[model samples]
Target: MSFNVGLSGLNAANTALNVTGNNIANSATTGFKSSRAEFGDVYANSLFLGSAKNGVGSGVTTEQISQQFNQGTITNTGASLDMAINGNGFFMTSDNGARVYTRAGAFGTDKSGNIVDANNNQLMGYGVDTDGKVVQGVLIPLKVDTSALAPKPSDSLSETMNLNSSAVAPSVTPFDAKDTNTYNYSFSTDIYDSQGNSHSLSQYFVKDNTNQWTMYATVDGVNPHDPTSTVPYTATLNFSSAGVLGTTSVGTPTVGAGFTQAANGKFTLTDWVPAAKNAAGVMAANGSAPADGGLVMNMTATTSYNTSSAVTAKDQNGYATGSLTTLSIDGEGNMFGTYSNGKSKTIGQVVLANFANVQGLTPNGNTGWRESASSGVPVVGAPQSGTMGTLNAGALEESNVDLTAELVNLIKAQSNYQANAKTISTQSTIMQTIIQMT
Candidate 1:
């Protein structure tokens, strides 16, 4: 009986030492959780003896090893794909087809552009549609699309300018794009076609009278009405005595050719063919068509004031094809890809899984855990949603192990082992003494 008690004590102490050693070993591991060994006192029981008031403790037995799920310190790693959870939740990954959960966020892109961990396990997340909208309630492996962004044609152009009302008529009679004396002021802007081709649209303003002006428009230095002719498309601007623009008239050559005034008081150019200039300064079609529904030009903000003629604001909606430039992740786990065209689109959103009994999860090595019957089904959702925590991009979570505490535990376990060994040795000596007396 004494031998059995002493052996049990030794076994318990050894187990404690093993647990402490493991905790100390993983002190520097990322996302490692510390564990502790729990023990219970042992005693013999008999139905006939009932409860003995002076019953002596037999020994100690290992009961269980429990894990600590406390939050670890987050450190910035400056890697774009690295992520860290700030609170409760684990990053869900797919090892082949099996779902695994982990707190380690050291992730990178695989050969196929799929975001994966060191083990090549793909990370799971919600995907985005072509329009960059997040598709909820569906799980998919997150991948980065590196395809070039398609170009968008120009459909709208807006300009705001103040024409000098005190300016006199140009000394020249007719507008000549090559002669500055034929027009008081001129402005040019670039507009895109369906094929991403750019064309220059120039406007020349000539003061005709006290409150009237003649505007000549050209595309690539030629008439938009008849590309073969050098005569520019003409429009008359009539202003009230108060210097406010009123009813306007575009010359008959442009009334219905490609430019028309809409009921909303804006001009719409529906037939302006995209053209390019040759080396000899001749303009011709470039085989690209205008945007669908034509280009809507808003010039209602034009004011004729007694000031210097200048364009206050001008903008066009168009872009050329672009390639992916950078990737970023936000607190909500939304991944965005920025392109060289100065545009950004949603790539995917990372999803996190949380269990009701996190401690009941089965360790699957590599800092990952598998769902078990003891651990309730995973509650998966985007970060910062519901009870889940927010994500920190370009960062990682460090192990929660405390080296000082583990070292103290190591000393205690060693002392327990020595005491147990001394007990066994003393028991052997007593048996020896009994034998010598006999």
Candidate 2:
């Protein structure tokens, strides 16, 4: 009986020593939690015992190994994909078909463009819709869309120009693009078509008389609405005596295309043939114009000032297809993909899950945990919502193990083992003396 008791004590000491050694070994591991060995006294009563006071303790037995899920220190890595949780939640991931949870945020893109851990297990999160909004449905492996972004057709153009009010009328009778004497001032702007091809559109202003001027607009030396027609679209601008723009009228008869005049000389260019390089490398008209002309020339900001003609401001809406440039994550774990075309889209968000009892979680290796019966069902939510924690981008969480504490526990376990060994030795010596006396 004494031998059995001493053996149990030795086993308990060995278990405590193993636990402390494991903690010390993983002290530098990321997102590693420390464990402690619990013990209980073993006692038994004889069937013929007359009183309970006669019963004696047997030995110590290992009760349970409890894990501490405490927060660790967060360190920056300057990598956009590296993330760390700041509160009481774990980053959900998927392996084979089962869901797992982890605090290690070291993640990167895989060959299939999925955000994955070092083991290539995909990180789980809410997927995105066509418009880049979260679906709010079942959690799945988060994928980074790596396809090139399509180009958007030019829908509108805007510019503000000034005409010289003090300049005299041109000496030439008819307006000409090459002859400088035919017009008083000119301006040029680049516009895009459905295919993202660029075409230069120029405009000339001729002072016909006081508070009156004739304007001619051309696209790549041809009329925008009709590429075959060499005649440019013409309009007459009528201004108030105080230099404010007033009424406007088209000079040429409506021949299937021209400027659609609006209030305050704001004309919308109607019809446009998308310009492209032909077989001979020369720009030719392609039948790909915007159905709505897609060009808005704003002369509302035009003024008859006594200065040189100048284009003060200009803006257009069009771009070519672009590739992904970089990515970023916010505190809410929203991952945004920035493209080369100066556009950005939300890819996905890192979803987190918390449990009612973190200690009840079962370790599944790879610094991850699986839900167990002791732990209640996971509460799913986005970061910063309810008890869930926010994320820190470009960073990671260090292990929570304390080397100093583990070392101290190691010494205590060694002492317990020695005491148990001494008990066994003393028991053996007494047994030998009893045999010799008998």
Candidate 3:
């Protein structure tokens, strides 16, 4: 009977030692929980002798109980793809067709642009509109379009100019009718044509007289090749002596003066038509001095102006069509993409997944775990919202194993096993002495 009790103690101690060894072996394993052995002493008694206090003891039975889960320390890796749950949530993932949950965040994008976890489970998110507003009930797979994105140019532009009323025309002139020696004004800017082709645009100005000027534009060159009209555009600007803009005879209010178009599609400057003296009957041999020879002066335009002209031009509004450049992620998980055209755009935001219960997760190998019946449904959202951790780009998370604690537990289990062996040996020695004396 003493040997039986001693053997039971040895068996129970061995079971506990084995359980501790298993814990030590898997201390470094991801998502591993340690278990402990439970022991119960057995009692033997007859139905009639059950009331007696001197009942015989039978031995012990050992069983494995619940595994204890220790919260692992989280180490930041700083990767936008990498994620970590600080509290009670787990990340939900899928294995091919099966669903899984885990606390691990090692994530990446596939060739198809799908955001996947370690086991290739796609990360989900809410879809966003053009303005980045959430579209409810929309489950977007975390894939972004890597194609080229460009800036949208504004639709309108404006320009203003001022002229010096006394500058004289130079003696050397380039045009027989006009002086190349005149202030040849040229201002260039970029503008996209109707077809989205960008061109270097220039507006040329030449002083025709004191209060008048001529304007012409060379698009892409001194004169752009016009496929439809077969001619470059030319116009004139005219001002009254008081510097007030005149109106066209066709009832078009002229805020400023310019050449008028003829029925033949030709442009000509406005010249004084000596008021047809009383219907051509009262005209003198020479027309009376032309009404106040239009004020003479050189044109000097600056960056300031106030005009109501409906057609305004810009200095620089277009860019050269370019290819895609580098990409980056921001604090809000927004992906900003750059292009060779000196333009930038917001591509999309990264998605994060969270579960209701992390401890109830099922292990899926590769340091990943999956959702089980005990784990509630996954709650998907962007980082930094609703208990989710913010994204840190270009970093990874370190394992949460504690080596010092595991080593200490290993030593204690060894000592306990030895003590239990000694009890078995002492019981055997007593039995051997009793046998020798008999």
Candidate 4:
């Protein structure tokens, strides 16, 4: 009976040492959780069911090994795609046709633009729809849009400028872009066409009176109305005594058109005729008119004051084709992609999952776990939603294992082993003495 007890104690001690050693080995591992070995007292029955004083308790036996799911330390790695959970939930990933959950966020993208972990298991998430909204359904591998962006035609433009009131009117009658004497001040901006082609939009301002100014607009130095005629699109500006603009009158492009004009006399361009650039970098007139409507220019804030002439703000809603430049993930797990054209779009969102009995989950490899019957069904959701946690981009979670605690446990295990060995040695000595006396 002593031999059996001593052997069981040695086995239990060895198990403890293995558990502690495992924890120490993974101390520096990312997203690693520590584990503990548990044991129960053993009291096996004899072959004949003998009772009373003959009963004896056996040594300890292995009961269960549990994992500790505590929050790990966060370290910023400066990796854009690297992410960490701040509150709760695990990053749900998919293996070869198998679902896996992990806290490990060391991830990279494959050649196919799919986001994956070190083991090449694809990270699952919700993709965005055309409207940039998250599409909730069965999870799929998140793929980034790395293709070149499409161009958008100029739709609206706004400019706020202050015209000099003390300036004298230009002597030139017919406005000509090549002659600087025809206009007082000129401003230019780049606008995109239907084919993503860029064209220079120049506006020349000529003071007519104390409160009146004329603006001559041109594209690539050519009049958009008629190529044969050098006269650019014209507009008249009238200012009030307080320097605020009062009325704006644009030259009628067509004799009969359905363009809507505002009560404030703001100019509206409905149908724009496309133009091309010549070898000399001048915008040459194209014979075909663009099917898309023309560009709308707003100058409701134009002012004629005694101060120096200056343009306060200029903004246009048009951009040429661009390529993907960078990516970012928000706390809500929304993945955003930026293009060279200065436009941003939401592409995907990270998916997170949680379990009712986290302790009951089966520890799978890759710092991940598998769902088991003991662990209730997974509750899947987007990050920061419900009981799920928010995400931290550009960082990773360190292992929660404490080296000091494991070292102390190692000492205890070694001592237990030595004591059990001593017991067995004493039993051997007593048996030898009994034999010698007999």
Candidate 5:
């Protein structure tokens, strides 16, 4: 009995040592969780003995090994693809068709542009639609689109400007784009066409009377109506005595051949053809057209004030075709790709999976865990949503193992092993003395 007890004790201590060694060994591993070994005592008794006041234990037996799921420290790695969870959640990945969960966020792009971990497991995420909105419920492998972004034609122009109410009209008879004497002030901006080509749209403002002005516009220094003609598109501006712009009192504003002003007082340039300077210094059509809905110009914010004529703010919605420049991830796990044209779009959103019983998960190799029957179904969601955690891009979570505590456990296990060995040795000595007495 003593020999059996000693052997069991030795086995329990050895298991403890092994568990501690494993914890210490994985102290530097990413997303590693520590574990502990538990033991139970064994006893044997007869039914006739009933409840004996003093019962000797038969031996010790291994009970179970439990895992600790404490939070680990996050460290910045400066890698764009690396991610770390700030709270509770795991990154769900797919190896072939099998799904696994992990806290290790060391990821990179595979050859096909899919985001994958070191084991080539593809990271699952919610994909975006054509409008760049996240589509939930459906899970797909996240991919980075490296194709060039198509250009968008200029469809709207918003300008806020102040025209000098005290200035006199220009002395010149006809409007000339090159002659400064022909117009009081000029504003020029770059607008994109359907083919991603750039063209200059210039607006020349001439003070006609105390509260009236004549505005002339040109595309590439030529008439928008006729590219071969230098005659520019003309419009009249009427301002009230209070310096507020009123409805048109002269020639009505027109765009293209038949496009006219809407009831909202906004002018739409429907027929402005994109043009470029030829080798002979003549502006000609470059085979590009305006946006599908035409370009709407909002001049309602323009006012004739006593101040100097100046454009306070002006903006146009258009951009040239661009290539991917950089990628970034936000706290909500939204992956954004910035283009060379100074535009950013959502590529995809990363989804995290959480379980009701994290300890119930079965450990798979490569720092991943498979969902077991004991572990409840995965509660998958985007980061920062509901009880899920937020993501920290360019960072990683270190192991939860504590080396100092493991080292102390190592010493305790070693002492327990020695004490058990002494027990067996003492029992053998007793047997030897009994044999000598015989």
Candidate 6:
């Protein structure tokens, strides 16, 4: 009986050392939760021996208890592909139909643009529609549709160009068909075609007279509104002293791939003019110009006058040529891409999901987990909402392992194991002495 007790002690010590070794080995493992060995003394007893003052004590038994999931330090590593769970939750992923959960947020877009975890498991999330909005109560696996991802032109063009409001328009000289050239202002940028092919588009604003200007534009190698296909596209921009759209404008003929412009000389100065007014007020039809009267012109056309057929928007056939710029993502996951044409459009938004019992999830390795019967259905939601953590773009969350704490625990477990080993040795010595005496 004494030898059996000593043997049990030895077994317990061995198990404790093994547990410590496991902790040390996984100290650097990402999303790894250190575990402690649970021990309980066994009592040898029976109803028939209940009257005994003390029953024989059996050695310790080893059990791996639940792991501690306290929050880990969230170090921000500037990686857009990195994600971190700040609170009580794990990222849900699915391998084929096998669901798993994890705290590792290192994610990236696969060749198909589907968000995949390190193990190639698809990150589960609600799908966002074309409008970049997630429908309620519908939880589907999320995947980025790379094939369908394409840049689209903007539907409308908005511009605020500032010119010397007091500048005089040039007189109509046959040699200078566009008298507005006196002002001599030109700006150019690249605009995309229907196929997203870029083309250089330029606009020159020339002062024609006191309040009129002729705008000339060139697209690709051809002029969109040339009179004989030999001249550049030209339009008149007229403005009253008060910067109001004047009645003098030209009706352009349909030309170009997806745009039309008025014939070079046919566009009148007043047709596309906008109301001209200084900061003060509009100028009167009478010769009385407001003290701050200036040349301000704004014009919009029902038809695209500059864009190529290749530059159509997603839901529309054509967009204004002036609708191109850069792209950006906001905290709300809204993706905005700008075009060289000075236009920006919402491209798409990111999606996130949540689970009711993240702790109840079963680990499936590779920093991932699977949904078990213990874990309730996942509750889907966007990031930074309710219990969900805010998303930090271009940043990744580092591993949550506390090296110091793990080391300390390792020391404690080792000491405990050593003490148990000593007890076993002492017990063995005593049993040997008893046997020798017998």
Q: Write candidate 5's Cα lDDT for 1-438 as tens digits.
A: 489999999999999999999999899989888999999998886676766447889889999888888889999999989999989899999999799899999999988999999999999999999988989999999999999999999999999999999888888878788999989999898998998888898999888887779888887786677676666777788888998888752243333352456533467788876456689988666788889988888888989889999999998989999999999999999999999999999999999999999888999978899999988899999999988999999999999998899999999999999999999999999999999999
Which residue window of length 10 is worst by lDDT in model 5? 249-258
TM-score, cand. 2: 0.81
Off by over 4 Å in 3: 1-90, 128-137, 150-188, 193-196, 203-218, 222-324, 421-438
lDDT per prediction?
A: 0.88, 0.84, 0.53, 0.83, 0.88, 0.53
TM-score of every prediction relative to native: 0.88, 0.81, 0.56, 0.87, 0.93, 0.65
Query: How much lDDT does candidate 6 score?
Result: 0.53
- Candidate 5 regions exceeding 4 Å error are 45-53, 249-259, 275-285
- Best TM-score among the predictions, by candidate number: 5
lDDT per residue, candidate 1, 169-189, as tens digits? 988766788999988999998
Tell me the tens digit of each residue's lDDT in model 3 across 1-438: 467776787777677767667667766654455665777878876676646568767778784344454456556555556655544444545566565555556778788867787567876555567865555455556665566544433232234454343444445554222234544455566654323445455555556677655555444443332212223335556566765433212112222232244422123223212222255575322232211222111222221123322223333344445566766665455666677878766656655566666555565566666666776667776667777666555443344445576567667767766876787788788889999999
| Model 3: how far residue 123 lies from native, Å | 3.0
Which ten contiguous residues of candidate 3 have the minimum total lDDT? 289-298
Q: List all candidate RMSDs to the true structure.
A: 3.1, 4.1, 14.1, 3.7, 2.4, 12.1
Model 4: residue 390 alpha-carbon error in angstroms: 2.8
Q: How many backbone clashes does candidate 3 have?
A: 22
> Candidate 5, overall lDDT?
0.88
Distance from true location, Cα of 426 in model 1, Å: 2.6
Count of clashes, each model? 0, 0, 22, 1, 0, 39
Error of 3 at 248 (Å): 15
Better of 3 and 5 by lDDT: 5
What is candidate 4's lDDT per residue for 28-99, written digit by digit as tens? 999999999999988866566656246678888989888999899999998879999987889888898788
